[model samples]
Each structure stands twice: as structure tokens, then as C-alpha cells.
Target: MCLISFFSLIFFSFFLLVMGISYLFNDFVLFIEWEVISLNSLSVVMTFLFDWMSLIFMSFVLLISSLVIFYSREYMLGDININRFILLVLMFVLSMMLLIISPNLISILLGWDGLGLVSYCLVVYFQNTKSYSAGMLTALSNRIGDVALLLAITWMLNYGSWNYIFYLEAMKFDYEMELIGGLVVLAGMTKSAQIPFSSWLPAAMAAPTPVSALVHSSTLVTAGVYLLIRFHVLLVDTFIGQLMLLVSGLTMFMAGLGANFEFDLKKIIALSTLSQLGLMMSILSMGYWKLAFFHLLTHALFKALLFMCAGAIIHNMNNSQDIRTMGGLSFQMPLTVSCLNVANLALCGMPFLAGFYSKDLILEVVSLSYLNMFSFFLYFFSTGLTVCYSFRLVYYSITGDLNCSSLHVLNDEGWIMLKGMLGLLFMSIIGGSMLNWLIFSTPNMVCLPFYLKLLTLSVCLLGGFMGYLVSDVSLYFFNISYVNYNMSSFFGSMWFMPFISTYGVIFYPLSLGMSMTKSFDQGWSEYFGGQMLYYSLKKYSLFNQIVQNNSLKIYLLMFVLWIIILLWLVFIM
Candidate 1:
């Protein structure tokens, strides 16, 4: 069944590629709608919009997923639930396809919910404590987006239709539309792991690496960016767009810093994914939707290949993920090392590689744009940090002395895994140029000064130097561990975001609830109801016992005294 699905996706990818090319030239759309409900002038319909964008994105999703699945055949060879894994991958791909094609908010929810649920399942596929916690974080973070989409859908009820494609243009000028726009941007932030929601992406590395290759690298994380690109018409010139621009810039810088500080191989790659997501969000927020989408496609190819390379190395090393413990495998696993180098170079945006075509163009465009000082610094800083982390990763994992014990045998002999990686390797090599040509027939014009033109290259060189210095010499000899403990720990732990998101968000509220329960419900209720009642009853019973013994004797004596007292009272009156 897995084999059938794999080959079918490959064939379908080619078919969609052809269709996408045809649609690019002819500019035709295929729309299909089926009414599901109608009442009092309100109706709901399942709507699919097939255009070049959907076709192209769906093709890439399917292609990457198919390759990941094939790779998993070897990567997950000894697992007991391989079939379940394959099914989850297929379902994830299907959800992504549904997300790509949907034009109506209602139908888009189907795909959106599918992705959240399927990804949660895949994240917890390992059933360990780490996977469980990561899955909870992943699901809960994405649930915020789900709720936002639900609110946005409810708001669309005012327009009498859930077809967001039709409403985007007409609603842009409407003040009420900002509500939906803001909600949509919020949704995108959570899905893309922007700002407060950023911690989940790295934590989700507890899943199997094949799942990471698909979910983090391409389909799942990019869903948010793709949705924003689709909604760009409504977001242009809005406050929400401006807010997104600021938030995304911060996210890009934060993730790049986190990646540089990270030592785990998969977490580093995951942080890189977060950084690229921020780049996509930042570009889209700046109204360069096409450029964002272009980078999205190209980043997907190389990042998937990068994860696969990481997976191959991890498999060879008996599942060790710490880059600190890995070194000098370039000779032992030549093919895997070569793929890793190519992917890393592509990630660094080296000329003519997959990332260069989109990343360089994005930097040039940003440099030419009239951005704020903070955004400007973020753009360049994040760009340099990308190089820094790529060099850092290479220095630790590829070029250093071998750090493993003598007994462990490591080799790049997984033929099936290599086959899967080779497919994406080819695409990562050519995807950038191909996407650039197809997406931008006429290149964007940027009138930057000479210094700005060379800024990217210059910063890249500085980043490389800094990366090597930090990873090799500074890590060992720089006695700043005590001096810069707080600063180093802050960046190393992703600005304390995971702690803030998990414990900070939950702790106070939970403590308040516990206090309330103890003070009001348990403490007060027990005192008033049980203890007070019991004490009052016991006092009454003791008084009754005393009265019973003294009653007869006191009555006889009191009769004569009452008569005397009555006589005395009458005389006084």
C-alpha cells in the first residue's frame, strides 16, 4: 500500500507539474462547488479552487511526502508500527492537498483541522514522554490558530458566504474586515510558530526524523504562510499586516540566534525551519506574497533534503542527535556527507543553489524597500545568522575530529534512504532557478547602492568567521561562562520562550485556581458545614444533659422563691 501511494504521488506530481505549466501560460481556473446546507438566505458549500498556485504547491507537497515515506521504509525498518507511520504520512499529505485547494473557509477548516490533528498524532507516534509533551505543545499551539480560524469563519457569516476567495477584494476596504484580517494573521502566527508560539517547532523534534523532514521542513509549517499568501489581498495596508511585519522580523532574528546556540542536530535544523518560516512571514507581511511563496517552495526542497541527511547520519550513529558528539563522518559516509554539504550550502544561499535564487532576491528586495530601522537590522542580522549557524553546524558535524567510540560502526549504506534523498537532492539543486523562472518572468528591479549590494556577501563572511570562532575557540577558552551566564543561557534556550510559553503561561493561573479551591471550597466549606455543625450539636447535647439532672430539684425550690419574688415585684410596682 505504501509503495502504491509512493509511485502514485510521483506520477501525480509530474501530471500536476505539467498542468501548472499550462495554467501559468493560459491562466485558467477550475472551480467546483457542492452545496451542503441552506436556510433563510444562508448557505454552506464545499468549494475547491484549482489554479497554478494550488497545483504547484500540491505537487511539491506530494513529492516531498512520497520521498519521505520511501525513506522511512529504511529509516523505520525495525519499528512495529511502520504501517501506521505510512498512513499518517499519507494523511498529512492529503490534508495539505485539501488545504491547498480549498477556497471556502468552511472547507479550508476541514484541511486545517486535519493537519493539526494528523500532525499531533505523528508528533506523539513514538509514545515517549518527550513525544507526548511535544505533541501536546504542538497541538495546543496550533489549536490557537484553529480557534482564530473558527472566529474568522463566524465573522464571514456577516458577508452571507464563507467563500473567502470572493470576499478578499471586496472586503479589503471595509473596516469590519479588519477583524477577520487580524484573526487570520493570528492564525498564521501560531501555525508558522511566530513569536510566542515559536517554541513548539523545536520541541516537535521529538518525533521521528522522517516526520520532521515532512512536517517541519515543508507542508505543516508552511500551511500558515500559504494561508497568509492567499489572504494577502485582505491584509494589504492594514494594521494587521504591519503587526505581522514586526512580529515576523522578531521571529526571524530570534530563531536565527536560537539556531546558532543549539547543539542538537535536529533541533538546529528545526530552528532553521522556524527562521525560514519567519522569513516567509516577513516577506508576505511586506506585501511580496509571490516572493514569499517562491522562497517557500525552494526552502522546502533543500530543508527536506537537509533533514534526510541528518536522519541518515543519525541512523548510522545509532540515533545519537547531539552534533557535539559527531565529527569527521565525511569519510565514513561520503554520499550522506555530500548531500549534507550541498543542503548546507544551499541553506547558506550560495550562488546558483536552490536558496540563492530566492534568498538573495529577498535580501535585495528588503534592502531596497523603505523599512524601519529595526526591521532593517533584523533582515540583515538574520541573514548573517543563517550563515553563522550553517557554518557552526558544519564545523561540529562534518569537519572536526571524530568524536565517537571505536566500537560503534557508522556507514552510509541505507540504499532506500539514499534513494529517497536523491530525489529531493535533484530538486534542491534545480528548484530555485526553476521556481524563479516560473514565478518571476520579469525580475524585480532593485536600485541599491554598492555597499548594500555586497552587504549580504559581507555579512555572510563575518557570520562564517563568527560561527567558527564561537564553535571552536570561544566555546573552549573563552572564560565567560560565569560572566555571561545569563545572556548565554537566554539565547541558548530560545529566549526562555519554551519556559515562558509552558510554565509562565500556565503557572500563575493554575496557582490562583488552586488557592481559590483551598480557601473557598475546601477550607471555608469544611469549617462552616462540617466542623461548625458538629460543635454546635455537641454543646447543645451537653447543656441538655446538665439540665436533665438539675431540673426536678431546682423546680421544687424555685416554686416558693417565685411566689416570694412575685409578691415583692407587685409591691414595688
Candidate 2:
């Protein structure tokens, strides 16, 4: 099964890559439709769109999936339900593919729902309380996006078609189209783990590392970004677009801050993924969807490599995921450490690496645009925080003396896993430049001032130095003197986002429900509505029966008494 799946995925990836190149060079978009039903003037059709973007995205997805599967073969070698795991992963990839190619709202919902459901399954694959809770959080959070899509579908029905590609241009001007655009943005936010919906991304680290590498890092999280990219025409200059900009900027800043304060290795990477996602979303919201897509692709390559390296490290360290327990493994696992450093550097937008091309372009574009102070600072500061956390991570895990027990053995001899990491490592180094040349076809001339051009690099250097200093024991103690435990906890806990998303969301609704039960469902509603009506009817019925069943003797006695009283009154008058 592994062999067959691997070969098929690789073959199709190459095929799609070639097709994508052809499509891009020719400036072609092919739409194929099969009608299922027609009523009056409306038709229900299943439609597939083949364009450069979809084709290339699919190829990348397939390539990553193949490598992740190959990596998982060794990662899950002794698992009893490895087959089930593989099938779930394949289903996830299929769902993403469906979402990528469909221009129809109905079809997109089908794919969207598939992704949410399958992801929940994968999240809880380990059968533990933590996994189950994480799975539930993931499923419920994504359900919001699903509902948004459903609303979008319902709204699109008014336009007499489920295919949204036809309406992208019109939506910018039409009121209803704007509403649909808003809904789509909402959907994207939930799926991409932007703000309020952000907590689930880290919680989802409960899934196996392979799933994290393929699904969370590269594919599922980016689904929302891709959706917005497809709908960019409508969102380019609208209120919803601006709203997305503010939200995504906040998300980016929040995630970057959270990553710096985190201790768990997987959670830190997850937060980094969230940070990068926010970057893509912010760019997309600002109307540079092409740049956003570029970042998405580049991020997918390096982030996947990051996860694989983390997986290898965890595997060697007896499944210990805490970074505090790790240090100085360079001698034992040089290959993994080298790849890990490259991936981290690529993530930090080091020159010529996969992230550098896209991230640098995004920063330049953002700097040139007329943005508010909040957004401008958020972008640059977030960039710095990203470097800070990354360097801190490297410092703790690869530079200091080994912190684990002397009896422990750490090595990177798993060639099967290393093979997958190496595949992505190569891409992490060169994928950005290759993709930039192909996607742009022409260079972006950013005529920025010298200071602005140097800003991104300067922040990165400052962030790296701070990362090292902050991780130092004496410096940490010095900072702790000023920084209280609560402040540290707040930052470490993602600004209490998990609590906000779970308790903050659930608390009010559940409280309202309880109040309703006390005031209505179990209280006045029952008394006035059901119980009051029943008592009123019963009282009236009993009175009527008493009148109907009156005795004749009693009636005669009362009639005589009434006659005597009438006579006496007549005489007095």
C-alpha cells in the first residue's frame, strides 16, 4: 500500500507540475462542467477548474503528501493501526485537492467538510484525553468555517448558480456580493486559524508528527488562505478586506509573541505556522494574493521540513517534546541538526532561502503600501518575534550542553525519515527563488528607501541577538525580576487564547442557556405557557360541570326565595 501510494503521488505531482507550467506559460484556464439537474433557469452542476494556481498547488500538495507518507512509514513502523493512519492521511489530501479545484460553493463545502471531519479523526488518532479534547476543539472551530461556507452557498443561490468564480468581479460592487465576500473571509479566518479561531492550531499538535507535518503545517491550514486567494477579486478593496487586514495583523503579532514564550517544541512550531499563516492572510487581505500564494507555497516546503526534523528529534529523545530537556545534540544528530537549522533559517527569511524570497517581497510590498502605524509596526515586530523564538529554540535545543540523562542515546540514523526531511530541505533552500521566477515571470521593482530596505534585515538581527540573550540563564533571571509570573504565563499561554476560544466562547452561551432554563424553559415559560393554560382550562371545565349537574330541589328552593324578595320590593315601590 505504501509503495503504490508513494509512486502514484509522485507521478501525479510531476504530471501536475508540468501541466501547471504549461498552463502558466499559455495563460490558460480550463473549466469542465457536468450538469446534474436543472429547474427552471437554474442548474446544479459539478465543476472543476484547472488553472496555473490550482495545478501548481495540487502538485505541491501531492509532493508533500508523498514525502510525509514515506517519512511516516518509518515513523509509524510498529503502529498497529498504521494502515488506518495512512488511509486517513490520503483522505485528507483528497479533500484538499477537491477544495483546490472546485469553483462551486457546494463542491467546496463538500471538500471543506471532508477536511474538518477527517482532521478530527486524525487528531484523535492516539486515543487519549488530550487528543480527544484537541480533536473536539479542532472540529468545532472548523465547523465555524463550514457554516460560513454554507451561508455563502445559500447566498450564491440567489445569483442562480453555485459557481462563485463567475461572480468574483461583480461581488465587489454588489451588496449581496459583498456579504458573500464577508462570509468567505469569515470562513477563511476560521479555517486558517486566524484570531479567535487560533487556539485550535496549537491544540492540534496532539496528532502524530507526520499529520502535523503534512496537514497542519502545509495543507489544511493553508486551505483558508487558498480560498481567499481564489476570491481575491472581490475582497481586494472592500471593508471585509480591511477587516481581514487588521485581524490577520493581530493574529500574526499574537502568534509570534506566543511562540517566544512557549516551551513545548511542537507547540512552538505550531505557533510559528500560525504566525506565517497570519502573514499570508495579511498580505492576501491587502490585495497581493499572488504574493500570499507565493508565501504559502514556500512556507509549506520549509515548515514541513521543520516538523519532520522535530519529529526525528522527538523520536530519538524518547518522545520527550519539551525543549527545556534538550541541548547540544549536534554531535549525535548532525544531519538532523543541519536540516533543522536550515529550516529555521529559511523560516526567518534568511537570504536566498525558500522563505527569504516571498517574505522579503511581502515586507517590501507592505512597507510601500499606505498602512496605519499599528499595521506597520505589527508586521515588522512580528517578523522580529519570529526570529527571536526561532533562535531561542535553536539555542535551547542545539547549542547548550546536553540536558537529558547521560544514559540517553540520540542519533539521526533513520534514513527513511531523513530521506523525506532531505527532500524538503533541498526545497527549503532553493524553492523560493525557483518559484519566484516562475510565478512572477517579471521582477517586482520595489523602489524603497535605504532605511526601509534595511529594516527587515535589521529587525531579524536584533531579534536573533535578543533570542540568544533571553535564553541565557542569567539574563532570564534578570528579566524575571521585572516580569511577573502572571505576565509570563499570559504570553506563554498565547494571551490566554485557548481559554478565550474555549471558555470565552463556550462560557457566555452556556451561561445564557442556564439562565434561559431558569427563566423560561424551566420557569415562567412553563408556568405561563403550559401549566397556566392547563390550570385555566381545568378550572373552567369544573365550574361548567358544577352548573350543568345542579340538583332540582336546590333550584326550586332558591326560586321561591327569589319570588318572595321580588314581591316585597314591588310593594315598597
Cα displacement (Å) at residue 452, model 1:
1.3
The Cα local distance difference test for each model comes to: 0.89, 0.91
Candidate 1 per-residue lDDT over residues 1-573, each given as its tens digit: 668878999999989988988898788899999888999877667888999999999888889988998999989999988998898888888898989999888888899999999999999988898888788888888988999999999998898888888878876778777788888888889999999999899989988999999998778899999999999976567778888889998999999998987889999999999999999998898899999999999999999999999999999888889898899888789999999999998998989999999999999998888788899899889989999999999899988777877556888779999999999999989999999889888876778899999998998889888889878888788745457889879988988999887774445656788999999888898789887899999999997887678778777877888999999999999
For all predicted structures, in order, the TM-scores are 0.88, 0.89
> lDDT per residue, candidate 2, 236-289, as tens digits?
777888888999999999999989888899999999999999999999988898
